[model samples]
Target: MAVSLTASGAAPQPDDAATELRARVERFVRTRVIPQESVLDAGGPAAGAALRELRSLARTEGLWALPLPAELGGGGLPFSVYAQLAEAEGASDHGPAALGSATLLDVTMLARHAGTRVRERYLEPLVSGEIRTCYAMTEADVPGTDPLLTGTRGGYAADGGWRITGRKWFTSGAGAADLVTVLARTSGAPGDREGLSLLLVPTDSPGFRIVRELPVLGAAGQYEIELDDVRVPGDHLIGEAGRALAVAGERLALGRTLRCLRWLGQAQRAFDLMCARAATRSGSRGALADHQLVQQHVFDALLALRTTRPLVHEAVALIAAGQDARTEVGLAKVAAARMLQQVTDSAIQVHGAAGLGPDTPLPALFRGGRAARILDGPDELHITTVARRILRDYGPQAVTPG
Candidate 1:
């Protein structure tokens, strides 16, 4: 089916084929994904094994290639339909869309710009689950700040190869990746945008090092990369030099849309679990589901999900149509990330000790809650984007694109 999209994020009037395709993918995800919850919660070799198994199941079921283009063996659904499938996948804890996996945001950006050779080489394996890649751009130098201030450096080698240096950390899934997309400064003094570039570097190249895995509130963050003289073939660069920032910019626009969608899923998951737990737990006189405070949190979680889901849909529609929804994405990221955290925290509150104990998925879910803040783009960065957009054009008349 040819999927049409506009910038308004509207769902193209769905046909029977689209509905059936989505339903099939959903069933496969629920059946193959949800049952592995405990393995994912533990977050280790076992979690890796479970994910590997699910990847195969998803591939066999035609669910593995949902996000890629048909040329690369993907289902080629429109972004709108893909967003919906992502929402469903996002709900599960152990499948491809789970928090531990390659986020839709990062991969989509690469899929857009990566050369066909790169796609066949790297992207193909990733979609096929033959190899998993990670993204490493955040660093101790910037320490949660701008990439412009990033200290990682990449330069040419004597054999027309590339050598990368500098310290980087907080890279998601880096510990388990076969390769990593690393962004680094190619020119120290170049004032123009030409100074940055994206590199597709193999993780095992000599001189590359993993200092340690960062621990986020208890869950392992995968890797803290410390690079020194890590060298690779000059062709290691993913795209042209001087466009690294641009690639990242484009990535964030698509990334935030997917991130918003994921946040919606996360909020709903917390709400569902909270409601079920509240209905079963006993309080003074009856089930906690009817208790005043429990009900309040439950309603609050539901409200957050309802409030954000449509906005995400709207934003995604606009993005799919090629509308410039930078402002919308910024707004959505701030709202969705904050709301998911609140919802998950409330879920923990309602579930009592079950929420805190590793015995239940609540604790891991809570970690996923906090993780929403760091994904796509940091919440604070987008908030700053909103503020700058506002202050720079503070008027009833919308800011005209310069």
Candidate 2:
């Protein structure tokens, strides 16, 4: 999966097939997916129907699961190439789910770490979109900033199984997920990093239940779930015992990188909307585009989009080649999140009253933009972590002794 770079250290241009696939995905998102945003916004049975229809169309169009493995009914595109398509596919929030790439993180993690039985049972159906999954790590009372604070407990059952008991909130898609990958303390006490383990618990398990819907900005999907001694066989473990954080670290790295690319795509969408609004909407003097302040918005949004893209792609390159890219991914994640918020806010400004209304997608995009800052690690955490990592590179000689 090594990528070839030019003399200037830039990645080589994508081949024709990759370029063609990207174009097809862009067109699909623009045409088929964008039109259904209103339905998705509404939520409920109609939205579910629309999503299923979109997924069927994606399959019929030969664009389903482009980033997953071909043997498992995916396009098998490499991350380096799929990174480009991810931006396009991510333009609509529902794009990844509809096209089957939504399972990339879970599928990849399970394929590499899950035991044979777990893989045999879940992998193919997951790839084919027959079932759904969600990751549960954050808890109701704990600061998600630290994984070492996880309080969920998983103990050995009398019959060589495991019994899990804990309550996890803000678990996205928990209502619809067939399986939830839960992080539990297997041996050590809270704050001990050596004892955490991941257990794959089926939603239909005896004691697993969704407590309530935890909405974000009046949107539904996130839920508070409780596992009251939920039991699963011993083989349900993901990766080695007491090494859940290590497995989670790898998963989050790729997940964050994908989120960065998707945020850029959403920002680009907002930028386009802003420019279109500026050029056409007549104000007191002339079209909004004539205003110097409006011009500044255009310039700033374009600058942020263009500049942030390279940082994201840099992270993508390193990740595709299986290299350490913590700094690059952190930089991309923060930059893209801020860029989306800024660009979407500017777009809302241009549209004025209409942007705040439900008629346009600006409000929904804005909500996602704002949440992007908090999800997948907050901006402050990334800023702090990235700084510490960079400083460590300078070693002892660069450190000043007090």
Candidate 3:
């Protein structure tokens, strides 16, 4: 309701509603969500119970799905305003999922491209936290950098439905998902970008099977799965046939931008931890904060956080305005990811061996920081792609933003 902001990421001055929403999210995450993060990380009946209770509390407190469409039972905050709150909501890895904003990308994609029947069946439940979904695009041995080499194939079945056969790995939350949005080649040959399409496949489909758990750096979330002729209705196709890349590209741009913002939140969390440790913990030379080396860590972490915030918010602004944001998003993605790793690493150093242990969240934060660089198109990919795009304009007209 009445969402407004000053320069997107800058501190809000006049928007009471926006500021209030942000404060509420920060308070909820710091007080309610962060406390239960360890329980959620442990993964068991208690974790599940804690998560359900937290989700219930989120709804009770009116903090659920603030970034989704109001018609779909969310608070309907625009991207610009939500971008600010995203930092707060993203302080914890579980924040978005707990508050329901985790569905933003999928919901946006489905709302724009999915058929009426598919939307009617899934959107409401997804937003209300009644069901969970995951995206499947990467293949077992194929490099994820090129979607044109997708090994998954979807073809028409004798029953007039679509049959999908593929092997996918690194599918996050696949083990517990009720549905999965799969990318498959419908008519394209190898190395051809055309003919790829997105399909909505129910996890309960007759031929769908989970092969194994893919633990990233020893964490339990991603999975490897096999779809052996899993079939779905004709209307389950997302967007136009042969245009999945365009649809996916749109989703990915926003998804990457959102991720950058979340990384900033996480970096800030790490920075806070580092500062607290530096101020209180003492060595033979006195408090850690009093040392020049420790102060350098604080200064460098602060500089990174400050510099990366504007780049991220610039990308957010472009996306909110529905403009080309590839350049901005690419820059933000790499910057925010590295910042997270740097800040978290510094934080771990300040804590000494204690950071590696499970006593605090530093170990998990550091792990995620390392993983962030590789996920959602690695830092190398973004750097090279953005550089290439910028260079191509030098031969002719000057470069324009994308």
Candidate 4:
């Protein structure tokens, strides 16, 4: 396929290796992953069966533990290369959806913070899919957005272990997780980034209790948890105390990027649906495709996706080269979220109410589109982070490059 450049940035050009990888992953998504999407949405045994199938398939294809470095037996592709496969996965509703508990993002965070021993024990199983992990970062109540009013607290225990006490909510994939990684203030004063610590806890351990699952906008839900003085060996601590949040912030960026690419896939799917409907749906000017207004919306959605695709490419290139992409990645997150949201909204509007019904895929696609807005720090926070950097480096000439 001859694809043109999307934005002012370079095109989404993949090396031979990346191209091959993308094709392989695309095949997996089509033949194996997408089938799981329906089973997962069905819940119960269907979901479990889907998970079993996906894990086995992912392992057989050697598509497991994608984000880990090559030394760790991962594909070691650049984030850009990863984006291509992720976008393809998300393009279909199935995302090659998961059967077992825990998000891949949670597993990645473990690779970033867990100690070597911890990595050998839990990390290996997690990468190998023997054990699943979930990130318990969101809190129930407090100024968690700012961290000044966090209710989660952690303290060193007498037995050289640590005890964490707090209530957490909106933890994705927590219900069936085997290993739960969480964040709490261990020593730092209020608002101090230094006091926060990331603890790796076992779900079956005493004091670690899952409260309940709360329905999100879509079919899958997030679980609320209460960590009551959860105790773990000192070795359970991920990285040095107070560094977890910082490390998490950095790691979360990767998670956000992966999610953005997923939205790209979903948006593409939505666009395909919109195009198909437009081709056959009757309108005053004959088919909807012949209507000027319909054409405008269709063109706009494609153009927006086209432009946003390259921003992601640029971010990937920077990251692959070992360059810091704090600004560009944040920018991509914001843009992708906005573009996908607009694209899906337009698709629904064009579909005329039928898009809003469960009879069609547009409804779920639209709901999933909503997550792009806040799944990664939200657009505002990421924009602010980008803005601050621009100002800090350029003095009074702090104009955002976007």
State each candidate's clash count: 10, 0, 1, 5
TM-score of 1: 0.88
Q: Candidate 3: what lDDT?
A: 0.90
Q: Model 1, 28-134: lDDT tens per residue?
A: 65677777877775777898788777776666666666766666566666676777666666666454543223445545766677766666567656655567777
lDDT of 2: 0.90
Which 10 residues in a row give candidate 2 its minimum summed lDDT?
1-10
Candidate 1 global CA lDDT score: 0.73
| lDDT by residue (tens digit), candidate 3, 160-226 | 8899999999999998899999999999697887999999999999999999998899888899999
Cα-based lDDT for every prediction? 0.73, 0.90, 0.90, 0.74
Better candidate number, 1 or 2, judged by lDDT: 2
Instruction: Give the candidates in order of lDDT, highest first.
Output: 2, 3, 4, 1
Superior by TM-score: candidate 1 or candidate 3: 3
Q: Candidate 3 regions off by >4 Å?
A: 1-14, 396-402
* Alpha-carbon runs more than 4 Å astray in model 2: 1-12, 398-402
lDDT of 2 by residue, 175-227 (tens): 99999999999998889979999999999999999999988887778999999
What shift in Å separates residue 255 of candidate 4 from its native position after superposition? 1.1
